[model samples]
Target: MVGLGTMGAGIAETLAHRGLAVVGVERDHESLRRARARLAHSLDRAQGHGRLDPPSREDLLARIGLGTDLAAVADCDLVIEAIDERMDAKAALFARLDALCPPGTVLVTNTSSLSVTELAAGTGRPARVLGMHWFNPAPVMGLVEVVRTVVTDPDALEAVVALAGAAGKTAVVAADRAGFIVNALLFGYLNNAVRMVESRFATREDVDAAMRLGCGHPMGPLALLDLIGLDAAQAILASMYEQTGDHRHAPAPLLGQLVAAGLLGRKAGRGFYPYTAPDSGEVVGTGTAVGTGTAVGTGTAAAVEVPPVRRVGVVGSGTMALGIAEVLARSGHEVIVRARRPDAADGVRARVRTSLDAAVAKGRLSEQDRDGALSRLRATTDLGDLGGCDLVLEAVVEDLAVKRELFTDLDKVARPGAVLATTTSSLPVIDCAMATSRPEDVVGMHWFNPAPAMRLVEIVPTVLTGETAIAGALGLARAAGRHPVRCADRAGFIVNALLFPYLNDAVRMVEANYATIDDIDTAMTVGCGHPLGPFALADVVGLDVTLAITRSLYEQFREPAYVPAPLLEHLVRAGFLGRKTGRGFREHRRR
Candidate 1:
């Protein structure tokens, strides 16, 4: 190991724990002492956690030799450079290591974004050079990306894979390229989050909450970027944009400015969110410092007094409708679900009951609470039943005509001043509002699938939407234990607008045969810490849905990038509508 920074120290500890004879080299005596202390601290923590006993921990520490000289790595079979992400600095170190190490020694770099092939070419042992990119906190994260350059020896690549497994890591191989596999997909998404904030589509907190709650991501994109360090993120994104020439990959101006001002995330005690101390996880305030209140550019969300909602009406007999109704009832509101027929209304009731029962089985709800929620829920085929509803949410099919017709009927049958919300993910909210006599009452309340679990509810208001309607939607979302983000009524709104294009690009990557499905999936999940890869997500979302979203985006903006991937279109045409049909990008068993 070379340069005993965070990555280097962690890698050394991991290797030593695996019983490898490891030599950790640093530049000077002071740095060497710090590296050894860091290693000791980490091992002490492991011992405290019962992962390592005292004797075993001491024995493991004995396997690692820390020194201030590169000559100490002379007899090692493999030397890994885990230093700063600068090409010139890394290249210089590799050139020196090449001269010092023995012949055929596998030289590995733990670079997250830089080109492994370029680093390899800087030395005399090009064929022996490869990337053994490990995730942060190497002893914990189980992933090791084995990057093979075109000139890399197959034997050298295999050796690293074997070594990674011996160190208790799952290794995935990838061709050497900018951002390689993980950072390529990851940093772009992070950059988009910054852009979303820059455009004021939503507040930074709301953006992070959406991914954390709505998408099941462990951390919001901004928080993840903060943990990764803003300077490091900017470097990775810059390298990616330079290599791919994609404008979307370009670092957001706000990100660059933040790094320039020395607000380099947790290391500096601030970046997207302020911290109480350097490297602390605790955030300082309610909202990000970059924007006032809940916005940046076009002013903040206006304060409006919202009327209380008692009875909520949900229209539709589909999964979303049942989920919404369940969520409302669970939130202590009387929920009336309206379907087209008596049988359909009965089915909706059964679905909601089954969902509530499952929640009880999973310990997410108590039996009493389940029964109470079911008691508050009623299903009826009559629109007249909604006349007393304080709020009526239309969770119908995605046809403009169907929604417009329903809104027209709702405007007539619903009580005066009742807020009308449509749960449309793609179609224009303005069109639905235009169909109703009270356009001011119609707003878009897009709830993610399985509304009871997902926490995000995008409150989209059209041009003519009144402040009371906006307040009502936000208030209801909060009352139902949801994180609400207000966005203008536009194609894709907040999340989908930024999300679908990336998924489309992933499809394009597959179409170009850049990598296999399993490889791509593994790369994103293991490397970037995504809950699911784009392909798996596309499959879960249904390819037809992805295509429709992409088409809406393309139609609205006419951007070539938003155009649906040909592969995606072809699969949808084959009736491979994802998990619904038991097949899509990959095979699945029907539920």
Candidate 2:
């Protein structure tokens, strides 16, 4: 092992515990001491958990030999380096190891991300050096990605794979590339989430909540960024952007600022959110700081002053409409819900009441809250009833023609200067604008599913949309207690635009059997730190919805890559509508 920080030490401890003699070489005495201490602590924990017996821990400790000499690993049949990410430093060490070790000795770099080919060629024995990346707290993380260069010896690759198995880590073989498979896919999503916050689209809390609840993610993007040091994460992403030239991996400005400020992560004194005291594990952020009551904003969100909003109008009566109405009423918006017909409107109102009451039963909402929320709700069969309403959100069906007709009708009847917004998740703002003669008066306000719970609301706008319209809609979403991300009119917009293609890729991976469903899910959740695997997320996102978005992207891009996966079609045909249908990749076989 070459560097003895947290990752290296964990890897060494894991190897030693598996009865393998580990020769760990660090440059300086202080570094060597830290590595040795970390390894001892890891082994002690393994003993405490009954995973390793006391005698085994002692043996494991005795087996590990720490040194500053590269020749120390000369006699070993296989050597793994977990050094600092500098190419020059690693190249120098590998050259020395290649000269000292026998030709058959397999060499590996436990680099999470770096070019394997470049690193491999650093040693004179190009066929020997490949990558054997370990996850943090490696003994427990259960993953080791073995990256192969084109020139890498097959036997060397096989030996590393066998060694990973011996060390009790799951191994995946991958082509050498920037960010490789895991971080390439992961960081793009994280960067987008940051842009969402940077643009004042949503608060960090709402953004994280929307992802966790709506998509079943374990942690929100912002929290994940804090965990993965902002500096290191940006470096990984910047490498991808430089290699692939994909704009998605382009580093957000805040990443550089935070890193420069030394607010790197839990290791640093602070990060995107600060830790009260690093070792205390108590973290605080803008809205959630210790000893502070007020929230910070980007001038705009701070300036938004919500009017004494009494009655709110909703121009649809579907589940989305009902959900929005319930959430609104629950938060004290006197909901004037409109459906096309009297029975439909009444049905929506009843559903909203039942939802509220269920919350009461679940102790999510008290009886007083349920009553207060319901007291403000009123069902209407007329759009004209919204004539004097302070705000009107159109949660109608997502057809452009249907939404345009409603907007035209509302254009004539809505109270002058009342915010006319569409909760159309996928439609363009300009298309919705053409329907209303006053295009500047219209904007897009999207809410995630189960509106009462999900907090993200993308406030999309066309060029014609006025600042006042943007401000008013943004204010309403915030007042409704939603994190609203603002964006220009585009197909699929931000979340779906980026998220759907990834889902399609997962479908492709499954179709290829590159990994089993369980393996892929585990690789993502445990290996890459995702809340759930893409397969699980796909089930929750719904096969039908995923298919629609994939087809839409294909229609726009005309790329074979964006084509919908056949498995998705078959699943939808089979009526496996995820948790709702109680069947998907894994059966949601009741409580």
The TM-score of predicted model 2 comes to 0.76
Lowest lDDT sum, 10 consecutive residues, model 1, at 292-301
Q: Against the true structure, what is each candidate's TM-score?
A: 0.92, 0.76
Residue range 1-591, candidate 2, lDDT tens digits: 777788888888888878888888898898888877887777777778889888777788798889988778889988888788877877777888888999888888877666778877777788988888787778788887778888988888899989989998887776677665567567877987777666555456656665665566677777778787888888988887887787767898877777787777677757667788763346664554222122222234335464655678998888888888887787777889888988897787578888888888888999988888878888888778999887788988767798888888998899887878888877776877888777877888888887888887877777787766778777777778877765656667666765776777666666765445775676777686677788888787777777887787777657565689899888889998687788877789654
Which whole-number lDDT from 0 to 100 does residue 572 have in model 2? 85
> For this target, which candidate reaches the highest TM-score against the unseen true structure?
1
Candidate 1 local lDDT, 464-577, one digit each (tens): 888788888888988999888777777998788877887887887678666567878887787667789889999999899999999999999887778899999999999998
